[model samples]
Target: MAVRKKKKDRRYSKGCNNQALLPRGSKGWPMIGESFEYFGAGWKGHPEKFLHDRMSKFSSLVFRTSLMLEDVAVLCGPQGNKFLFSNEKKLMQPWLPTTIAKIFPSSQETFNSGNSKFRKLLINVLKTEALQQFVPIIGDVAQQYFESKWKGKKEIMAYELAKTFTFELACKILLNIYDPELIKYLFGPFEAIGKGFLSIPIDFPMTPYRRAINAAKFIRKELVAIAKQRKIDLNEGKATPTQDILSRFIVYRDENGEFPGEDEIADQIQGLLIGGYENMSTTCAALVQFLAELPEIYHGVYNEQTEIAKCKAPGEQLEWSDLSKMNYSWKVAREVIRLTQPSQGYRQVMTDFMYEGYSIPKGWKVYWTALSTHKNPELFPEPEKFDPSRFEGNGPEPYTFVPFGGGAHLCPGKEYARLAILVFIHHLVTKFKWEKINADERIVYNPLPHPAKGLPIRIYPHIS
Candidate 1:
């Protein structure tokens, strides 16, 4: 009699709670939740498998899981992406793992109050018109980089070379830091920060998360010093207000006529540096690998770039107009990004919502992955096959190929990344022919995708 009474009470309790109707699936083990399996698939270099498995077993469009100790809804496919992206600031808001807040303490304040304003400041320099003026500067940097780093080497690690080149470009253009030694010195802690940024937020000694906190502290000190000096220079007219991003930040006054503090400026600068570093570098390394594997594609790019090269006198820098002619090259880059999508968008549910007859309670986390749409057979035929022609027409349907995400919070550096990739492609193929040293090298994601062996390749200068 007591057992029957208890069963009836349980049913009544569940009927009163909206969460009982959450999309189908398990939250996995407690404490860790599904984070192990969630990141495990990424570690195995096929992050799509996690979503693919769940989509097949449960619902294809949405499911429930837990990650980082929070109940999460994994929204799948183009429809899912459109829903989340289109509803930004309405039904959803940006969210980062708790680990980020613990490391960059200033991030929460910025995220809450100054995100839009800060993003506008960043977009000012990355917009197409602004990026147009930097084409020749990038061209010059690429030329000097190749001469110093790749001129005579018979073999080279493509990933390592790409990292250094992108880092130097970011430092010189963004921070106005030109000293090789200073850049090199800063690289170590910055790299530590990258490795620790998305790590599980455990603060124990010697852990990646702990190291990242320490590294961020060190970087904060360095940036604070830099910001303080820049502020002085700006007041004395010793530095131009538009000289670089640091100067611009120093001169910026918000609507309240207040300058952002040193800590906030440091945090934002670090974000930009890392933002421009890892993903662009990954794209560049993978671009090298794909171009080497596909000679037909290489020739297509080489032909286009050569025509542009012929139009210029010896040592002339590439103009913004030249980039427009390399459509096929850009298409190839897009396909590379599709095959190896680097980011996953995370959001927090802002209110109770109903979608596809499922209940999503407020405070639950939401994830929209590019892998689902990028690799879906229905959305992209023969998705594993590398075909640049997919982008030839009007392109993949809206939200299906979001290499840089979508909606109100689109990546601010999108145009800048495009310019950097095209400039690198021009310099790479027009100057040399290369073949992969390891034909079967595998890609692994240690929090981010990279070649298992750094992608070594044999270099042969094109016969002029």
Candidate 2:
């Protein structure tokens, strides 16, 4: 039932066949396309509605449209994930809007090998060996975060609190900057950069984009100063080359004696900071929301964490072994991620290719929605339900669940994020029992999901 056609030069030589080869669906109103509706559906809690409705209406595996003023093909289900992920850097590569590029650029272009050396060298520092030692570091950061920020609070905004904690941890783990005043100062401007990642790119004075640019400039200046100091420390034998990413960037040398220049080091670390800060914060907020709403699930997680907490004396550092025993806690975290994915993946077509017996023109954008695969009944029966047990033994089908993305583009900081979140959850569940102040709070998905009003929860500190 599939029709195939040769792709012809189409600015003029158009016909119904040209349309037929491109799949079925309106490109929507020129320029804006169906983006508003796409965002609306997500903001309204049916994030996958756009794809579902189009698949039904067009009766096709793919739907062609213009998103963000670019020709895009939104592919559906796990088959789509397989094709897009498998063909990464071969048939497709990341091609996001300029707004995203302005905030963090190298990530989308790593597929080209044009700028990969810089990124790969930087990621080399965040290897498993380095992260394996960060367990106690994150645990200690969590303990302090809870003591200073959460212990005495009657009510607090979960998103705000999580944002601070995640950002602080990122600074400590990635940059080795733990000064309280510096964290407080950087926190305010970074909010603008975070906002501008999804905002329209109008770089006028006072605009989010402009403010974000300004913030990036300031942060880059600070990073340059930090990197210079690190270089001196490395030369003086005053700092370990592997102490932090800054130090690693200072010391890393390739076989060719090439090293990341100071500017490239700043950009690379900035990308890691942007990535680690946002996803972890949103995910932590989601966990707080879920734990508040589902007491049975909370008790299950609480018991698991409390058993671990009970074994440790007050003020003792958590060992990597502690993280190993919280299997069920990890399950709950995975399910929370599935139920509320942080963002969708977008890739650009590299060469003209055939998929499922249809011609896909080169230079077009293709998107893989995580929600599409996560909610598919074929992969997860009753996908709406939050069943951590589903992940207890074997977990969901491969490529069918990609909360942290998959294939060549899997998030590099994934394990670190996992450990940080688990440690935070361990601290949270063992010490506090919380309930949402606004039980009916709704979620908004600009690029990631967070409560519309920033989830506010009343906390009851444990007295054990």
lDDT of each: 0.85, 0.79
Top candidate when judged by TM-score against the true structure: 1
User: Total clashing residue pairs per candidate?
Assistant: 0, 1
Give residue 68's lDDT in candidate 2 (0 to 100): 82
What would you estimate as the lDDT of candidate 2? 0.79
TM-score to true structure, per model: 0.94, 0.92
The parts of candidate 1 lying over 4 Å away from their true place are 1-20, 112-114
Error in Å for residue 207 of model 2: 2.3
Give candidate 1's whole-model lDDT: 0.85
**Model 1: residue 50 alpha-carbon error in angstroms:** 0.5
lDDT of 2 by residue, 115-154 (tens): 4565575456556666777887798899999999888899
